[model samples]
Target chain A: MKVLVPIKRAVDYNVRVRVKNDGSGVELNGVKMSVNPFDEIANEEALRLKEKGVVTEVVVATIGVAKAEDQLRSELARGADRAIHVVADQDIQPLQAARILKKLVEDEGIDLVLMGKQAIDDDANQTGQMLATLLGWPQATFASKVEIEGQTARVDREIDAGIETLEVDLPAVITADLRLNEPRFIKLPDIMKAKRKPLDKRELGDFDIDVPTLEVTETRPPSGREPGRMVKDVDELIATLKDKGLV
Target chain B: MSKILIVAETLSGELHPTTAKAVACAQAIGGDIHVAVFGSGDQGPAQAAAEIEGVTEVLYVQHDENNAARAATLAPQVVALAAEGYSHLLAANTTTGKDLMPRVAALLGVPQVTDIMAVHGPRDFDRPIYAGNAITRVQAPGDFVLVGTVRTASFGAAGGGNSAAVSDKAVDAELPSHTRLVEQKTGGGDRPDLQTASRVVSGGRALGSSENFDIIFKLADALGAGAGASRAAVDAGYVPNDMQVGQTGKIIAPDLYIACGISGAIQHLAGIKDAGTIVAINNDENAPIFEIADLGLVGDLFEVVPQLTEKLG
Candidate 1:
């Protein structure tokens, strides 16, 4: 089966996201950018499925600007067959981005769509499910384990309470949770091989999707938290919680 | 006529906190409310949702395959059914709600406010941005409607003992999943979910040792609180990644959150901003965790946590 993996490029998670001193928006001038952490899991899952030969062809796709090719090449180096680029900026809302992908999925003839549960930037875990709905396919989100049994798949789903067992047919969208797998780093040999891999770039408008007309009217730094004061000792802390009836 | 449609979720026939919270948010609109429920068998999940006050009727989606909601499948059906009546839609801001509700939003061609803590005006609502760091009261574009995923921790569980009549509705949702799951390595540790717990005991980098985190765990266990860690604490190898609570981590809003040896960074505060009552424990008097903390304890966590645990026990 052909697997379509969607990845995102966001601010490097390790960096402390700070608002610009001018109060415009996030300070992104010199900030590091990496593939969304969860997307790495999606990439890793695709590679693992390739190892089992269950997923015949694996391709990583992203809906972002031309610079996202940097992120896409890394996925190819990590071990994807090729890459599909839906050129746009990363700031578009989740549904708008999903709409661009909905138009692109038609030509791909994909059997399954795999991606992270949510992009770290927006923290909106909607795109995969939204894409599935647009395509009238099934979705197994927050999947911990995925196995194919003939035409059906048995899935172990991670819920807030714990995990539950589930099943569904082919042509589904699955979002990778944090515990899915640790993504492998690309070696020098693979990096050289990735340069040779076919990287296809498609304009968002070519698929009959309008570039969403939206803008960040105003963006500012998040509110500040006051510094905590050192008390005399532990006794005073309990005394305070007790007084507030919180303890 | 416009109304609010709800899908009250349940597990193992037990009422989930999110169900009541969703119902409560729906009732705040002071209009007709319709709830749809699905489960293995019986009206246990349905009955639990119907018990929430002001529930007009509970629609039981009695398809055998409707045991768990396949949102991709149900989104179209809900749009068709709900379009016949309601203008607005509502669900709890939960893992399931986050996963499934937006599918319906996408189908309806509306932006979903996935985690609204409160609602005001006719369709406008209030939601937190940057992980509850800033609350924005937004007026939706039009009758396009607002899908409010209520924050479960922020709203108290509805309890009016009001159970309405149960009616069955057939839903032949043809949703089937292609990706198959093999296994799950659940966090089988003895700890409550950070969202559901009333009290949370968090550790920071000052803990020094992951093994030394036993004190935080012990304190949490004694108080029936959830155990959490600052990003610094998790980075310093003092706790598991699941225990990390911050903007980039998990958004947690407990009734009482105790920060031990933690100097709260802005991102960390973003995660716990909605906590009803915050208590910061640290040696530094000017720790950032204290700004939002209702109660601040300046002391050595090593000396303080044991005493608090004993008091809790």
Candidate 2:
């Protein structure tokens, strides 16, 4: 079976994001960009499936500007066999992204699509579910474990209450959550080899889809909490709690 | 005036607290708010939803195949109801809401805004990005319906003095059958839920082992607070993932949060930033958690926790 993994270029998870002074969006000048952490986990899962001999090919796709190709190359160095880059100059919403991915799934005849549950930048957590709905396919979101048997895949998901397991047929969508697996580091030799891999480029207008329907009016830093004071000992701690009526 | 439809969330035939919080967000938008409750032979949640102060009407939809927890079956029903002249759709930013609302937005051919912290107007909202590091103000197009999920931690629950009418609404959409809930394994405990708990005490990897977590639980029990764990502790098998508090885990905003032995990674800080009062107790004074802590104690958790519990008792 062919496995398709959708990755995105986002701000490095460790960077403390600051809003632009103009209130347009987060400042991206000279900021370090990398594959979204959750999407990295998804790619790692797909590579593991390939190693287990369950998947015939692993293809990674991204929808962004030319800078996104750098992210695709990094995934290729990590283990993806090929890359598909859909060029978009402006930011696209989850609905448009899902529609574009749906077209790719049909065009590539993909049997499985693995992706992140949410991107750290937008935090929308919508693409996987939206694509599943548009395709009328089964979805196993926030998957912690996945096991394949014949045509059915058994997935364990991390939910608020506890773990819930579901069985979905082939041609399904699975969104990876944390704890799925720790992504492996790319070695220098692998990076050199990745430069020789195949990379395909497509345009956003190639697919017939509606434009994004949301607009950003402004952005600013969240209000900060007051600086806290230090207490001398346990006695002082109790006093502070009592003083605030928090005890 | 804009008409808003809220999808009510329920657990075990009872309305979840976030449902009322979603109502509070809708009320802020100044609209004729209606709530839709989908379940199987359970009118209790619908009745509970009607009692929320700002809710004008409650539409209870029942069917044999309707399981409110399953997004595949519920999204279609929500889409059908949204077509009846409702200009805005909202739900709590809980697991159910995060899973269901996006599908509704996709079916309606609109973009969804998730984790909305502030509603400035009918088409304007503020949502957190990069795990609450920044807030972005967004506006939806007036020509299309606006769909979003309210951040329950930021909004207080609507008051309960008013009574609204409840009506039965029929399901006309073709629900998807590709997904089904085989079994759910919920955590068995009598402790307060971490997400809505008024007070919480969380432990980190410094607790050593799963056996050492008892001290953390003991202190929480003494204070009648919920017990939480950092992602470091959960990944180390010191606790279950469900108890983890961080960007990938549950986001909580309790009245008081006590961090025991936690080094306070940025992701963990993101989860508790909304907390009213934060207290940090770690062996290392240089731990990042001290920066934001309202009260900092530079001591070993193993020694401080027992003494604190004794003092509280």
Candidate 3:
């Protein structure tokens, strides 16, 4: 079985993103970038499947500018067998990204596509589901636990109500939630080996997708909360709560 | 005028509160609003949807396989309905909406805007990014149908007054057979739902063990509040994932929120920023939770929680 993991380069989770002074968008200048945490978890799941001999190869793919190759190379070092970079000069919307991924899935003959539930940058949790619709494949999203057994994948999803177990046929898309798996650290030796692994590049025009449908008009920081006062003790806290009629 | 289509969400034959909130968002877009309800048999939820203010009609779609909340079966039906000259498609930014809306958008060959907190026009919306740290205003092309998910926390539920017409609609799309729901394990409790509760009490990793989490629950129960847990508590196995409140978890806006033993992480703070009044109780005086807390108390949770619970009782 061949597993494809779609990774994304996003603002580091810990960095405090600020809106531009001109209200254009979030400031990206000199901020740290890393693979989205959920995508890293997806790559980790694929690597585990490969290590267990259930998957023959694990391929990591990303759609971004030339700098995104660094993200793909990092995935390769972590355990992916190869990498595919779909070069796009500007940011592509989720639908276009899914369409391009659909084309790549067919071209690569991928048996399964695992990806992050959402990118922390845009917080748009749409790619995996959109890709599943475009390919007419079943999707098991927000997966906490995934098990592959003879053409079927049983996924336990963390939902609002509780855990929902779903079984989907092979050649499906699975989106990883936070609890899926802790990604492995890249070793120095593995990094050296990844430098020699196969890395393929393709252009966005190769897929013949529609133009983006959405455009960002502006961005601004959320209104700041008022500074709060500290109470000296539990009694003071209760008194403050009473004064505010919150108790 | 734009025609808005809202996908009604329900559980056990009753409309979810988020559905009404979605209607409020649709009303703000200044459209002739119609709601589509998909389920197996009961028409209770559809009838409820028809009564929401500003809704013009309710289209109830009944299918044999649509007994449960399966996005795979529902999205196709929604997509088929969306083809009937609807200019906009909307649903609540909830688990079900998140599961289904993207598929509907893809099938319609459009991009979806998720978690819209405000509507400036039919095509312009404001959504939070980076866990509510920044708000981005976006606009979709007017030529294509706009698809979006409403942030329920930001909107008030549409009131019930006049009843719109309800009509039965046929399901015209082929449903997928590969995805099957095996079983669902729901956390059983009588407490108010965390997302809609007026007051909430949350515990963190400082609770130490799952057994020790009873203190948090006792406090919540005494206060008649919902029980929530920080991601740290959920990750540490001190609570179930459904009880988690944070950016990656459920975003809640309650009137009162009590943070017990929670060292405020930014992600955790994002969930409760909309809460009216925040109270933090932690032994560490310098915990970041105090930075946003309206009332901060420095004390051991093991001692403070029990005392708080007793005082409330």
Candidate 4:
């Protein structure tokens, strides 16, 4: 089966994001960008499924600006068969992104779509589920383990309560959680080979895009927490808790 | 006034406490709050939802398809009920909400705001992005129905006193058969849930072994707080994945949080930043956790944890 993995070019997970002084959005000019961590895990899972012979091919797709091609190339280097870059100069919300993916799934005749549960930038956590609904397909979000047997996929999800196991038929959507797998590092030979791989370019207008209903009015730093005084020892700590009625 | 519909979260036909906290957020929004309880077997959760003081009405939806509480089934029902002139649809930002609400929004052709932490107005709210490192104020257009999830940790549970009316309701929506729940394996038994616990004690990789984790659990039991773990500890198999507290894990805002042997990563800090009082106990005085910890102690966790547990006892 052909698997489609949707990746995002997001601010590096380790960077300390700063809001623009104008209250427009977070400052992204010249900031370090990389494949979203969870999406990287998704890419890794798709690659593993191919290695296990469960998936016949792996294709990675992204909806972002021209600069997002860099992320697409990076995933290609990680062993995806090809990449699809839908260039969008404007901000694409989760709903629009899902709508675009639905078109791609139909156009590509894809079976399984693996993606991150949420992008660290928007933190919306909506695309996978939205796409599943629009297609009337099954979904497994925050998946830690995915197993394929014939036309069915058994997924283990990490949830607030604990691990939940679900079984869904093929042509399902699975969003990767952090523990899905440790993604492999790109090898020099693979990077060179990726240079020759197929990279298809498409326009955001090529598919139907929904107008966004949510608008951002302001962006700001979280209220800072001041470091309080430290106690001398266990006695002092216990005394402080008692004094504050925390204990 | 905006009419609000809260999707009550349930497990085993019982109301989850997070539903009350979502009610608190609705109360803040100043709306005619109605909670929709979807269950197949029991009406207990619907009666419980009615007791949340600010709730105006409880609508109980019963169907055999609602047995597993799958999002694919619940989303269509929620969308159908939301057609009754509800202006806003809300759910707690738990796994169920995160899984279910976006589908509702997509079906309704509206964009959803996840993890609403503050309510500035009916259309305006504050939500965290980049894992709570930055906060953004979002506004939904008044022309369309709004769908969002309340960050239960950011608000206290609505007090229970008044009894609102509960009524049985039926929704006509086509449910799918593609997704099926195999089973759910829960851990951290007999402990207060980490997300809503008033106090929490979390351990890190420094705990070394699962056996050593007992000391942390003992301290939690002594203080009657929930026990959590850093991703490092969970990855090392010192604890189960459910005990994990970090960006990818549970985002908690407890009254007091004690970090034992955890050198705070940005992701770990993100989860606990909303906590009321943070206490760090690490042998390394300069661990990053100390920077934000309201109270810091420099000591080995093995000795300090046992001593602290004894002291609390």
Candidate 5:
């Protein structure tokens, strides 16, 4: 089985995000960048599937500018056999991203698509399901565990009340949740080997992927988290809550 | 103008609270509000959705045993039912809703705006981004016909003004059969789920160990609240990832959120911002958590927790 894993590059989880002075988007002045956290889980799971012989090849895919190639190399270093880079700066949203990816999947004859539930930068949590829709394939999101047997995938998902088990056939999309697996750090030898792995890049125009602007938008600082007075004790806390009618 | 559709989801043949929230948002958009449902069980949630303040008609699209699971198989089924005339489609931004709605948006080839706190003007929304550190006003693409909304604590939950009429319009969903559900082995905990509970008590790495994390559990028990954790607590191997509440983690909006030992980061705050009242307890005097706290305490969690526990004890 061929496994296609989608990865995204965004600001490091540790760095604080600030609104751009010009207000177009986030201010990326000087911040660390890394693969979106949940994507790491998907990558690790895809690699494990290959190791267990459940899958034969793992193809890592991403949509971004040229700079995102570094993250693609990192994914290859982590264990993907090859990479597909859809190069474009279309300011694409998750739906458009899914459209572009659906074409890639059909072109590559991908049997399964593994992705993070959401990107930390936008936190939209839209791509996997969106791609599943575009492809008319079954999808499972926020999956903590995925077990494959024959042409079906049995997954345990982390929901609000209790865990729900879902079953889907092959040619499905599964988004990784946090407990899926712990991501592995790239060892030095593997890093050296990854440098030699070939990365193939294709422009969005090359594939004739049409992306239209979805929305006119501006970003602003998150609202309603103002500072409050510190309470001295539980009594004060209770009193304040009562005064605020929050208890 | 065509009406907006709301997918009222259910579990155990009952209406989940988020369904009511979705109904309310449908009402807020005000027009002909249509409620849709699936599953083989009773129409409890659909009936409930119809009764919501603004939902006009409840449309049931339940299939046979072939698609009993609420897995991604429900995507095509949902989009097909929603294929009729509708100006926009609204779904909760919860786990199941997230899995299904994006696929619906993809099917429609429209722009899907997620995690929307508010729908400002028609075809426009205000949603949080950058881990809730910023708000983006997005004008959706004209070609697509669906828009999804998020639970904004009060926005959707409070739009309960409509009484609905239940209708059974059988649909040929032809949902693909799902894999069989064998078993669900879950952790043993008396606490309610952090994402759905009205109140939550969270701990940070400052709790030191799992045993110490129990303090928050006891407090949560006393308050009948759910237990949550910061990424620090989860990354330190103090708790499971399901309990981690943040941007990358579960995004929750409880009525009351208590932070013990946590220094609120932007990501953490994003999940808890819609919380009605926030109380923070941390040793650092200048922890960022205090900025968002409706109430705060500066002290060591290890010492403070035991005292608070004993006092309640």
Candidate 6:
């Protein structure tokens, strides 16, 4: 079985995102970029599957600008067999991303598509399930534990209620949650090896996906919270809570 | 006027309260709101959905294949219902809605506005991005059916008073068999639901271990509050993922929120920003949680929590 892992170049999780002064969008100048944390978990899951001999090959793909090749190379260093970069300079929404991925899945003859549940940037949590819908395949989102058995995979999904287990046939789409696996750090030697690996480049226009227009009219910081006062001890805290009728 | 269709979230015949919050958003959008209850072996959830104040009708779609509420089967049914000339489709941004709504948008060939925090016009709304640090006002094209998920934390649940008409709607959509529910394991049994609880007491990594998490639960039980945990506590294996309260976990807007030993990360703050009055009980006086907390106590949770719980009792 072959697995295709789709990743995105997003703002580093540690960076504080700020809206631009003009209210157009977030300021990305000189901001640190990394593979989305959830996507890294997806890559880790695929690598573990390959190590277990359940997967024959692992492919990592992304849709971004020229600078995104760095992210692709980073994934290759982490044990992806190859990489695909569909070069799109402009920002793509979830629908277009899913359509492009659908094309890639067909062209690669992929048996499984594993990706992040949500990019920390847009936080849409859509593409994986959308791709599954377009392909008429089963989807298991927020997967914490995944085990492959013959032609089926058992996935433990984290939902609002609790962990729900599901069995989906092969050629399915699975979105990785935070607890899926902690990604491994890349070594210097592996980085050198990844430099020589095959990295194929394609353009967004190659997929012939009809993109829709969603306009961002403005961006702003959240409303300010009130300044707080502190109490010296538990007694004072209880007094304050009772005064506010919160206790 | 926009005609809205809300996909009611249900599991094992219980109508989730998140559905009522989505109804509140639909009411704000100003439409004839019809909620579709799928996967219910009986009509109990549908009847509950009909009682939401702004709901105009309830459509009960009962089928054996929908017993699990799998997205692969529900999306096609929702799309078929949207084809009935409805202009908008909405659901609450819980796990079920987050997993299900996008597929419905993909099948309808429309872009989705997720976690709608505010509504401006029929096609314009505000939603949070970058984990609620930045708010973006987005406008969808008027030509397509608008699909969105409501930020349940930002809106109150619609009151239950009006009795809406309930009808059985049969969809001709084909259901898939590739996905099957194996089982489910739920935690925090008999406790108030964290998402809808009026008061919540959450612990952090400072709790040390799963056994140490008992103090937080005991306090919660004493106050009749829900028990939650910060991502750090959940990551430290002190609690299950379902108890996590953060950007990646459950975003809640309880009336009173107590943080024990939690040094508020920005992501955790995002989940409780809408909370009424925030209280922080951390040994570290300079912890970031104190920045947003309405009342702060600088003391060890081990000592402060039990003392507070005893006083409350």
DockQ of each: 0.27, 0.75, 0.80, 0.84, 0.55, 0.83
Estimate the Cα RMSD of every predicted model relative to the unseen true structure. Answer: 4.3, 1.5, 1.5, 1.0, 3.0, 1.1
Report, for every candidate in turn, its global Cα lDDT versus the true structure. Answer: 0.74, 0.90, 0.91, 0.92, 0.77, 0.92
Instruction: Kindly give the stretch of ten consecutive residues in candidate 5 chain A with the minimal lDDT sum.
Output: A207-216
DockQ of 5: 0.55
Fnat measured on candidate 6: 0.87
Q: Across residues B1-313, which tens digit of lDDT does each residue of candidate 5 receive?
A: 5488877666556666687776666655567878787767576667677667766688876667523446445666667766687877777777667766777777666667787677666566777777778778888656467568666454636445566677777766665554445555445476775656888889998899988888888888877888999989988888876688887677787888989999887778877888878889998989999988878888778777666656544
The CA lDDT at A146 in model 1 is: 77
Ranking by lDDT: 4, 6, 3, 2, 5, 1
Per-model TM against the reference: 0.82, 0.97, 0.97, 0.99, 0.90, 0.98
lDDT of model 6, residue B238: 96
TM-score for predicted model 1 compared with the true structure: 0.82
TM-score of chain B of each: 0.85, 0.96, 0.94, 0.98, 0.86, 0.98
**Residue pairs in candidate 4 whose N, alpha carbon or C atoms collide under 3 angstroms:** none
lDDT for residue B64 in candidate 5, whole number 0-100: 70
Q: Over 4 Å off in model 2, which ranges?
A: none
What digit string (tens of lDDT, one per residue) describes model 6 on residues B114-226? 99999998899999999999999999875799999999998898999889999998999988889998998888487888888889999999999999999999999999999
Between candidates 1 and 2, the one scoring higher on TM-score is 2
TM-score of the first chain alone, every candidate: 0.92, 0.98, 0.97, 0.98, 0.93, 0.98
Error of 4 at A120 (Å): 1.0
Model 4, runs deviating above 4 Å: none
Candidates 1 and 5, the one with greater DockQ: 5
Which residue pairs clash within candidate 6?
Answer: none
Runs in model 1 deviating more than 4 A are: A18-30, A89-91, A148-152, A188-193, A210-220, B27-30, B68-77, B107-110, B118-139, B154-194, B202-218, B221-250, B260-269, B280-303
Tell me what fraction of the real C-alpha contacts between chains A and B each candidate also makes: 0.32, 0.72, 0.85, 0.86, 0.68, 0.87
What are the per-residue Cα lDDT tens digits for candidate 3 across A1-247?
9889999999999899988999988898899999999999999999999888899999999999899888899999998999999999887889989989999999999999999999999999999999999899999999999999999999999888778999999889999999999999999999899999999999887987775578898889998778887777667777777788878
The TM-score obtained by model 4 is: 0.99
